[model samples]
Target: MSDTETHARTQAQPRPSDAGATDAGPIQTGTAPEAGRQLPTNDELTVHYPCKYVPVELLAGFGAGCWPCTYEAHSFEEADQLAHPNLCGYGKSLLAYAMQPDVRVLVLTSCCDVMRRVYDVLRDAGAVDFLWLVDLPHLRGPREVARFRGELRRLADAFAAWSGRAFDLDRALASFVPPVPRVDDRVTLLGAHGPLSLVDTCRDELSLPVENGTCTGWRLVQTPPPTLGRAPHEGSCHVCQDGCEAGIPRGDDLDHFLDWYAGALLNQMPCMRMVDSKARAKLVGAPGQHGVIYHTMKFCDYYGFEYLEAAKESKVPMLKIETDGTRQSAGQLRTRLKAFDETLHGMAEAHEVVTRRRGADGGPTYVLGVDSGSTSTDAVIMDGNERIVASVIVATGAKASRGAQNAIGQVLERAGLREGDLTLRVATGYGREAIPDMDSAITEITCHARGAHFLAPDARTVIDIGGQDSKVIHLDEAGGVLNFVMNDKCAAGTGRFLEATARAMELSMEEFCRVGLEWKRDVKISNMCTVFAESEVVSLVADDTPIADIVHGLDMSVASKTAALAKRVKAEPAYLMTGGVAQNVGVVRALEAVLGSSVATHEDSQLCGAIGAALLGLESLN
Candidate 1:
């Protein structure tokens, strides 16, 4: 094909819209309807496909709208009841979407086993009017392309008969839209395809250009070679039996188009399902790529393997997030994304400058750092010399913000200083943003690293178990966060977990911390889930288990979980244990046994995050 011919062919093709579109044309695939585009009427059939293997342009050529199967269910309760509980969330959500009244036709591909099961369930329930399962070839070759082309033809015939619309050769050719080229630096999502909600969150919250390179988002279609003008009276020419009508190709050219289409579909960037997916490295290591946000669905093994492989290949910072395709985990997702953004952009420093009020006798200026945690609020006040002037820790009753304010007020009173006496106020922790009084907010991971280094200057690893989450942070000598790992959305090895177990045993927090110190009997607590662990503890208590042995088991379980997190980040000692849990002697001893090393703890371990926040505030003044 000549350059002129290629250019002309490409210009004739449609430009794909921003939705989940194939290279051939725009396909609306997100949860919400596209702006200014009304929903398809009853007569206007819409075909929804789950994977890229489906021939989307063919449906568009048949006068039916092409849409990708992306749906966000309010809850997975209905899907869990219909499908197996172990089914992938995306597959379950897709099945739930199939039952919706708006879903007219569904085109599923044999991409994954869960999707195939979803097809069976939807078909058995008679969910949609039309359902077709296209057999997607795992390997990309001429033979596979030819086989896929046959399947495309079968789908075309079925869809045409169902919609009462004939496929127009000109329309199909016109529907071929070129892929948009990305020029600017952007973060690429490189693992299993995530829900549209996640994509939107990354774009909106991170405030960075994002490229979807996941299985569902990567659309790779090669531009076809240009052909010479056709002659009239060609075989089965619907446009003019034609040498050509309106300088366009006739229906006789459908075979050639199908051959090209088959090659294009097979030639897309190989998804993780492919036997060899080295091509994925190009997407991850692309020039101008800033970072990678790898998303994986729960119970999906394919993407997890891909993520591990990609993480090894990509040089940029990568964050792995796992979601169940529901909004329940949105908060945790936002936290991880925000911290990743901070790491990329260096936004943890306090941006606002507060005028330092000099002491009446020329004493040093004071700064305050507040850490509003799920269980407690800690405040630290430091002078210009980095010496702690005052500190306070208070129970975070209901509102974290209120607890932070109360702690700050108490610390200021103890320091004999007013709010104006402080040069800057920095906040950290789960409720950092809620503390409006703070000049700036930083993630607890960064703050914890800083605090741990300040307390134990030689410490290279910091393990912090707060009320709701447990995090293991590896740090450099200068207190920079090298890498970190935290427990998932579940409260497993956190302070809350211990509190729950203590409540189940009807033991005070002080008593609970000391009961397990001398325990020698082997009382194993197998369950780590907060709810299940509580139940197990209750059963043990009912069976007349010794309180010391039961407490020891609970402490060991917490230590095992925390130690695993520490090992994941390759934590090195001298290890510093911080956060409220550090005050628990039983947990500290248990952790020491698990790590086979002595752990360091300071008198103000609970105030480390607040102290780190204060140091950041002080640095901003400098």
Candidate 2:
């Protein structure tokens, strides 16, 4: 069998890790580095790079060239303080190890707004000498390349300036290659939009040798566009062309030599905001367009914005995946990839077909999926033919046990079936642990990906906006979760944020959605924090800004924030939008406008997780 056929035939087996194991690790315990690379301890400053006086070995170690400093921690009071409240947990842990008198330069990348502040913390706290701030470009297209390349060059120069050493280009490139293949011979590139742990889990489950270039400080090697920037070739390699063209946007002051000196050489021009008709035209010329495009929820604005147009222009197949930093979508990811590969290889018995139900001998399949969420428990039941039988949503009311029982009872009662009559019961979401009665629990990440795939099997990306949190997942062809990103620390850009804003505005959720749809003029809301956003809205109302416009602005703000988060993890789209936010037409419209693609949301969109969980229960029973 061909490599493609063999992979396609492989069942998308899923192995979920124990709860809490996702966050706890040898890296967290401060043992050996997870990647076999470790920074110096407090008394081991002599072994660090950009050293005041470096021994040669420190300079030669892999991953030793750049030091990453996160902003979650700052030793404002005591350098020796092991822990500090208000500091980010990851940041604090990094700082605790970083301040061990390990004298060295640090490389910082502005992955988020907090990252920008990290530099200030380092500078103000007297923790850094040679600080290289790698400015991040917006998740836009090829315009971002220049900024990224320039930032990388700045970092390189900093390395030379501090240690009088330059990067060996050949050696740097070689470091990216795998040292030796693991025995599994299954190498997986788990593309994600957020942190490394999610990818790590996927690698572990599949026993695949993995390379995490996304998390490491290593930069993407830039490839120049074709001479004269030839028009998009419809027959060219789509991934290579699109990837190459996906550069950072140029700065406003390209002529200003002085502005180029600061890391923000792009002059604050959003990378995706560039006028690149030439690139687009050339991209459209590529032959046999992209095989798949994966987008995260909320963060789909940039990639999602470009995808439909790009797909139209390139005529490529596309997909979407969603996640919340947790690698809970492996099964769905495997499925998506399999389907995509099969379709690409022309081996699929049926060309890509997405339907609510497919099995024969049934009006509908009465399967049940239960999503035990943080704020509520939901249940969705489908017949053998995938027709909806009963769907139930109820307040969890702090008693997940009672809440789940109530939801399941309601759905079962409505379906006129006893609990045992259901063919399957799948459970999902953060509160998976709260329900011991579940036949089996699937992660929300996997469930969301599966649900999105069920709705749009071609979807390579999914964004789920729930009450307390939000996530963007990337999937392969079979709707298996390949990778994911999540919002962990704050409630901004989530359904909870919308709820708070609605309450503060003294508008019902329905009213809030209506107000946004009626907006006549654009008003921008700058803050994403719930409290700050509410304050901004209050001031806008006081200032007599039209309520409709203010509401519109709020929706736009949420879209922008989600888009930003999704970009960090490298989002693409056959975009699927899920969670409660998918039901809010106002926010959905705002997101669709911002992304320039109509998001896929079904009448049962809000019940996707529950549906997925119910499906998983069937798989487990089998």
Candidate 3:
């Protein structure tokens, strides 16, 4: 199995890395301003705008260029340390990126409270030389259009004064380029303004074509009238046209240009802030759209409501993912996208891979599957008849590759088999890419669904709470993945949570599990954050709270979170629990209580992922 890392970088914009800035100079102005604070003094101004309403062509009318500043930060070290803890990750990321020296100027739109707060923080700190917040009206009416026209004219004049250059109206008018609609099957990224990095991830993971259909992607401003010093037939390509009777907008001419510019900005597909949002249907209902990958930011609730509605109404496949807009969720992001891709393509592609590459002869053949997770590595071997012959589990240790080698060696030896004896070897889990001697790799989500069906045919919902992440997978009647949901990027409801609390209580994991079931009273854990949970546990222990009660409380905490995830996927009865956490009887009982149903756990629960991998590989081959 290979390590779960970033599938792709934020597309287009060069997001600054911790190693060093790739944006060296004028050509690439996204570099972070360091302690030396070397601000650019040249006339070639660099501008970053997160909103689509900001007129980059207008900015170019003077001298400045533009960069769309919507990318997840590597970390919020500087932001969390200095900015408000409650601020959303996207706002924090924008604040952090604005601090870079390369971002000398920013033309921010007053889109939301968070954006206004960002402007405040930047203004107070003097983060950039030129910081301006353009006021946007909520409604697109005649009066609002007139108001926005004046706002644009003022902004143009202010920029003209700052850069010591005249506003080239013709140049600004020429910047009005239109977009063409796609006709081929593709995955449309809907909901919330996400960074280019997210779009890049969707493109890399999914089998079909992917495009950002979010608010930013809908920059559908029309070209102005040719009489207003603008060329026609610019089309979708934004190709420049020569031989035009173009001239600067002067007197009444200037007023007319401003009117068109303001109306165009307001008339474009409205964002959540706008009143007429009926046009948003185009985002998901676009032509040739196969599926929708909806992204929402943590604590951002507006788009979440829309996503919920879309999930119920839309006929196409839907995958809803959320993040703090940081690289911390990178691993889980890859896992979800990979599984979503599997869902989009269905079982045909999977069966094709096995048959086309290698299948078993009509004879005795041993197929192997390896699951390398963050905490442990598991391996399972199956014969031609799909009977489990042997299985082994080992600590993942320092390197996932080493742990995989150890697990593979032990399972092969137990089955009395060699490397060449196996007909096919499939790997799954976080470290699937790192494991050596693997013919194919499948996501644990898909593997878990197959494994759960194999273990308990009656199960419709599979709750797999592993070392670092937890997921609720919904399977169809025929053991195919129908839908799924994952928790936030935290260690609240996983094995890691139990492990940490056990360590704090000075009890072994086994003892902790035993004591949890012995509780007489229902102790409540307030917070689900790992660090805070541990602190609450310590306080409870100091208050002379019974150890059994505290242990049960932790179990309940995990159960509550897992139940929420299951509810998102509309999970049904006959639930199956897998992964290492399935060994904990206390958690199993707690989940049963929270879910108001029984949760079945098999002896080989930890090996379910590996078993599923082997079964899938066999099915693919034969």
Each model's backbone clash number: 6, 82, 12
lDDT leaderboard ranking: 3, 1, 2
Question: Model 1 off-target regions past 4 Å?
Answer: 1-44, 228-251, 312-314, 347-364, 542-545
Q: What would the TM-score be for candidate 2 when compared with the true structure?
A: 0.51
How does candidate 3 fare on TM-score? 0.86
- For candidate 2, write residues 1-622 as lDDT tens digits: 2222211111111111110111111222212222433433222223222111111111222123322221222333442253334444334434443454443445545644434455566665656444445666544344565556555455544444444333332232322321222222232231223233434443443322333322221122122123212333333333454355444332222112112222222332122333442332322223322333343323224334555464444444444445432234544454444434433343222122222332334433567778887777899887655666888999888777788888989999988987766665666776665775555555676677667877788888788888878888777888765555677547899888998888878899889888788989999898899999889888888899988898888889888877765664456777788888888888888877777777777877888888766655444433
Better of 1 and 3 by TM-score: 3
Residue 444 displacement (Å), model 1:
1.7
Assess the local accuracy of residue 218 in candidate 2 as a C-alpha lDDT between 0 and 100: 18
Please give the CA lDDT of all the candidate structures: 0.75, 0.53, 0.79
Whichever of 2 and 3 has more lDDT, that candidate is 3
lDDT tens digits, residue span 398-510, model 3: 99999999999999999998887788888999899898768888988888888888999988999999898899999888778888987647788899988999999999999
TM-score of each: 0.85, 0.51, 0.86
When sorted by TM-score, best at the front, the candidate numbers are 3, 1, 2
Task: State the lDDT of candidate 1 residue by residue for 1-622, as single tens digits.
Answer: 2322211111121222222222333323322332443444434556777676677766666655666665677888889888898988888889788877767678988888987899899877777777889888888888988998998888876765554455555656556666565645678776775567888888866756887666676555565545512322234434543244554544344465676788777777777777777766666666677888888888898888876776656677778888777788786677777667765665344234454544455656788899988889999999989999999999988998788888988998999988877777888888888988667777777677778888989999999988988888877677777667778588898888999999999999999998888786979999999899999999999999999999999988999999987765667888899988999988998899999999989998899999888887777667
